[model samples]
Target: MRQWNFRYEDGEWLASTVPPADDNLTAAVETLVVPFGENLQAVESYLESWGRMERENGFNYSLSTPGAVARRVSKESVEICDLYDQFEDTRIPEAEFISLLRALSTAMRRGT
Candidate 1:
């Protein structure tokens, strides 16, 4: 099975086969590993939780299209764009997106 490691690099998200070395970083960073598979339900659940968090925080956003891209729609902008922009890949695979959402959901659930 193939796995991809995603990390925040230079204010953007980058996916690569090899994990970044500790000596190459300045601060602590979390990485998500995505395994290839079908996980539609997981993706949906993550999106729902994500939307809920945004709504609770008073930000207007929407998950749209077959690609499932989440975008901010409100005039009052937030840091979501910067977060999304970190995803360097033009087309993010469903499994990868689900992994990201799962991490976010877990963080939210833990109240961290």
Candidate 2:
């Protein structure tokens, strides 16, 4: 399975399983557009909780298409699900997902 990762480069956010050496989303299998301002605050809150909304409920962020979402599937996993069958879902460990988001958030803040 491909290992998922995220980054912010040239003022755009990227999500992919590409290696850090690539540094671009050209090969990304999935992408999520995250806007600025209040959305950043929401991201911060999400980061603080690691997308855990409640005891049984977690987080679900839409992808580029309808029904496609990055969902918190378990205490240790986050899955990018394509509900319309356009593509296969991808899963990443929660710890790694949080780390990727944290780094991307910092990079976004630094304008890097």
CA shift at 71, candidate 2, in angstroms? 1.9
Model 2 over residues 1-112: C-alpha lDDT tens digits?
A: 3345446666556566544423222222234334443246655765655434534354444323233455676667777665555556677676766666565567557755
Question: Each candidate's lDDT (Cα)?
Answer: 0.38, 0.52
Pairs clashing in candidate 1?
A: 13-86
lDDT of 1: 0.38
Q: For each candidate, C-alpha RMSD in Å?
A: 12.5, 5.5
Per-candidate TM-scores read: 0.29, 0.54
The model with the greatest TM-score is: 2
**What lDDT score goes with residue 84 in model 2?**
56
Q: What's the true lDDT of residue 47 in model 1?
A: 70
Off by over 4 Å in 1: 1-89
lDDT of 1 by residue, 8-99 (tens): 34543344333433321211112221211134455456577656867575545544433223444443332221223333223233344445
Show how many residue pairs clash in every candidate, following the order shown: 1, 0
